[model samples]
Target: MLYISSNLRSLRSKRNLSQLAVSDAMKFGLDQYKKYEYGKNTPPAESLLVISRFYHISIDLLLTVDLEKVSIGDLVTLENNRIVLPITVDCNGNNLVEVVTQKAKAGYAAGGYTDFSFISELDHISLPWLDKNEKHRVFPLDGDSMPPHNDKSSIIGKYIDKLGDVVDGKTYIIITKNNEMVYKRLNRNGKNTFSLTSDNSFYNSYEINFSDIAEIWEYAGSLEREQFKPETNDINNLTMVIKKIERDMVEIKAKMA
Candidate 1:
């Protein structure tokens, strides 16, 4: 309830709405609404519901989250007080997506992901095709663990706050607290862990505890940079296999001798 007063004031101020105007919109008495803003009295649950609906924010968020510390975007629907990522837009009102590339992943995992200043300072790009209502980010991947996504190609993901919404066997960008950033297909390993498997069979699957995860972004789309001319060197692959077989035969002969 401590954040309620400041949140009320902050929301109103951001919209440039007068107290009377807000009160009239919510059908709340001006004095009562003023009391709520001034922290003189806490609104009843019903009144809070009215305000919540009017603001299009969850009651839990209104009562708990410090609005001043966060930049609110009406785009993301807040459910059960889940963190609403600050959504920024360009001058033309197109949503600006902040990118977290392979090089900056360590910094991002080291609190830059949650720090407002750090997020704002990162590079941004605008893509109009994505749903404007959802929060999105672009992550450029480099590894061959997930094939078909050309190395260094970028993937756009929608931010999902609740872990419950993470469906099994879906690809996602998982950021762990241990400063690890990886994109892999996921499954429910248990009540508190996620089983991650790479699309490429060369990489082994592993499980990550729920407690270790910092953020999970659902795969939305990709910006795959098509390789103009691919190197087709099957002879090298055959040579390696032949060498491996020759080494195995030599080891067997040595053992027999």
Candidate 2:
């Protein structure tokens, strides 16, 4: 309870809100507000609601120990009397979703050329982001570009944006000049190649042909580990590799159609 009060004060201070201002907005006297913040009394449901409204927070955040506010469907852990909320998909018409993160691509690639047999099976595949009118699939991240943490192989069927034109701020899996697929955050630079960047600092930035891309899918979510291990996982890296190949397959099929 004391912890909650401290958090309230801390949050108010961070947001630059005063208790008196909050109480005035909620129509409460300063003394009553002091009691709530000082742990002298538990806040009433109405007061909680008012605080939630004023702070643009969920009631769960006001009275609970969960400082990281996630969406309704996000995974949450109630441990050590604190809430640990996992970041999750936005249900408010974001039009992206997660799929099976295994076996995104198949067959073999010799040199830089790929056999279409494995790619052929992926054609006409439906993704969670399609949402009836939109046609897209959830592409997963692959290779060392996103490695040292996430395995390229762990996210085979994850989502990526399949919108006609790649928009800024959306993430994508891209194939580089080395014929390697990488899970990169897509930041468009002019009309030529897309800038593929890894979130981790250990990896370097590079460009992709864009034309050689097999497909463009939509991004949805990630499998977050409880702990952040400094070393990257090889299995996860390969999983993303297969996913990028699968995206390339989809791109080829689209060009043919």
Candidate 3:
């Protein structure tokens, strides 16, 4: 009952290819390929593999998913039993890093990240330091929860496809199911949760369930809106100076004693 005839037809149409053209590329008789589009017959496994390779799509997706409704990013393919990302590349042969601004943050958290139209509408930049093969996205920071990356700044995050790749004590931009987007230093709490901590001690740390995390982007680099000033009146800065002074006085007292 799960026929791939429609899916095949949709993909071909999307690519603006005629049935005859596809059949010629596949080296199959025109009549035989027509049967596949007409829902009278299905392609063999070998033929399916050929089609998948030609279209740069996965066989599982070709057979199971509605290609018309799914975006390229949402498609997952298995190579050697490992999942592969369908990263989009620009015509200039450069990988595009999509920027998630404060205005678009809500849409991204609400599952718009995987929508082709939504993603296309977002502004993109190319980073020379970033590998063309790696998937990346940029997110804007809103609060002073983390120093060095204060309000009006943005962090470029490399897409973390698997949860097991998350490193302890590293910073990440976490997107939650309820649209809670935050940048925090991460620590593994257990198998299913992570301890999220802000650099500023004033904000208490807490644990977040992995199930609530919709997406995770590992911190790669940052862009500051304004020139960084070391003399900012942050409470953490004053606290650190006071603590250093107190430690120095204690050392002097111990030496005298």
Candidate 4:
């Protein structure tokens, strides 16, 4: 059975709260609260609710996850309580790549990436090309906006540690504060915005402000659903036709000679 004792102690220590202060805030006897932290007794549901509210954390997390190992930045608010990111680490303490499918894309945009319960419900798989030490996430692509990457393909992205690390002319998966996820070739426009261009000229490029960006993932590699077919424009088609006619004329001339 999972015990909340160690988690409670860790939370208190992280906040540097005194046991007596916590007991006083909960309006419980000091000895009773001490027993709760000592694992000799469990707090009542009401007391647990009060403690959870005070810490701004969910009761489930307080009772299950080891809070000492979780970083503050990794937590996100969900239904009035904070939950840690659902990152799975191997025995060697390496992060595993989590795949975001079409079905899970909407949820991921809704802060599901940091919600342990939501992330745990999604499917996870490992990739051979990715290093275990590097943080990565796979996102499924949907349109021909970025040709060659096409519809139904998936891109493996390495998590960019900072916005300053973004390189120009490289592809990235940009997650916006407005819950839009876009895959585009990025060019830094200024300190506050980026020019996002598409490989397919049919779609026009646009700029997104850095203030609106929630996260940035650098394109590492891609997995095609099938053989890739490059998008062709009018000029490309005309060039192909001209080349074919020239080849035919050369064949006729060789036969005549």
Candidate 5:
């Protein structure tokens, strides 16, 4: 969703700056500035760059994040400015993790960064054992590539604000700018990119550039939607071995007789 229009208005108002003053400073005509603020028109790439530098905020954030709901100062301070998480808190001030449902997973990579209301509409639950101070969210597992965490389970993730902060070999819920989310173990390739490998070896490892990333969420914990499945292979193998031993003993007795 486009938010630059509302963001322009919010940023200007928050700094106690008048529209006329901002228009003059931005070298934008008064009417043009009004049109941008009112969502009548979107700014071109050149204008976006100027606005981004002027506001000291990334263009991705300016165009996506709702500045009205988040503090511009905090958003600017975060590394990469990947996303403004609409993390909610409980009455006791504990962080309540928003659970992204199975259906919502598809849209999350898009709305999770762009729309504040979209996130708020998601169901939330509190995991008190975790550090109450950190931002976290719940995402449903999509494919079997990450074993033991198929569509039948969900993973709780701790938000990683910057791509560089990711630890090698650690699992993370990575959201790509192409609007795809996948869980994988990351290995930094020393080329501003990551080699994402799946737990299930059937899936080949792939390299993804830092620019392709939209958000990073380090794996915190997991919730199993299905019960543990017991394998009978070992039990059947043991039974077959015992029966073979008995047949061998009987054959020796028959030869002696």
Candidate 6:
């Protein structure tokens, strides 16, 4: 409401961060980056946290006030005693896709990239296969557990939530036993154990005591769907390799049970 984006842009300029630099930190390409600063996009709560942390400010500052209008340095203390500073967030979508693909090739996916996907209130997303409606969240599938799904599809697009809001049934992108990344529904059994259920029969469930998870970041919005595509025939080959990797990863996980 306070044109906070203008303040952000001003502070970023003062700090010598070009628009490209900010985009890199946010994992957004130049186009998405421009849209963010221009207020065409609003980041999620997690993203807001990351941005505020980068500026050494509370979320309140970024959400409600503009530091530029008050004749302050990049840093500012609000009436509520919150601090704000200029920060840079940047990333190249194409490069990220390549890196992520390579990670899949290596049979693992690391956690570092933040989710940028979002859903609008007015949007309608329905899945007949799961008998669900109006439940949706854009999740970047990290590995090849769903090779058919990721093939010809960018990892950054919107995914229909067939499992609804039930926390345990919520499908999540998680690390499997053999070190590959995957999307699986999380289930909590009565015994302090959690199950990683995969929809693909080729990949089995990963059941753990729920203590081994390294980190879990919830899904956000869809990446701009049209942004990525593999340029060569290697995509198909990569897909096959990833599918086999995911299968082996799942087998190893099932054995851990």
Ranked candidates, highest lDDT first: 5, 3, 1, 4, 2, 6
lDDT of 4 by residue, 114-157 (tens): 56667656667778778765678888887878877776799989
For residues 36-143, write the lDDT of model 3, one tens digit per residue.
888899899888778877776756556655667666553323112123233344764345888988899888888775455677688988888997656799999887
Per-candidate clash tally = 0, 30, 0, 0, 0, 16
What does candidate 2's lDDT look like per residue over 61-169, in tens digits? 4554434332332222111111221112233323233332335432211111132233323423334433533323333444445543354333333322232356776
Report the CA-based lDDT of candidate 1 relative to the real structure: 0.77
**Candidate that would win on lDDT:** 5
For every candidate, C-alpha RMSD to the true structure in Å? 10.2, 17.9, 11.8, 10.8, 11.7, 15.8
User: How many backbone overlaps does candidate 2 show?
Assistant: 30
Give Cα distance to truth, residue 177, candidate 1, Å. 0.6
Q: Which scores greater on TM-score, model 2 or model 4? A: 4
Instruction: Estimate the TM-score for candidate 6.
Output: 0.32
Worst 10 residues of 6 by lDDT: 89-98
Q: What local lDDT score does residue 151 receive in model 6, on the 0 to 100 scale? A: 37
Question: TM-score of every model?
Answer: 0.60, 0.35, 0.61, 0.62, 0.61, 0.32
Looking at model 1, report the run of 10 residues with the lowest lDDT sum.
75-84
After superposition, which runs of candidate 1 have C-alpha atoms over 4 Å from their true positions?
1-84, 91-94, 228-257
lDDT of 1 at 188: 95
User: Between candidates 1 and 6, which one is better according to lDDT?
Assistant: 1
Deviation of model 2 at 4, angstroms: 66
Cα displacement (Å) at residue 59, model 1: 16
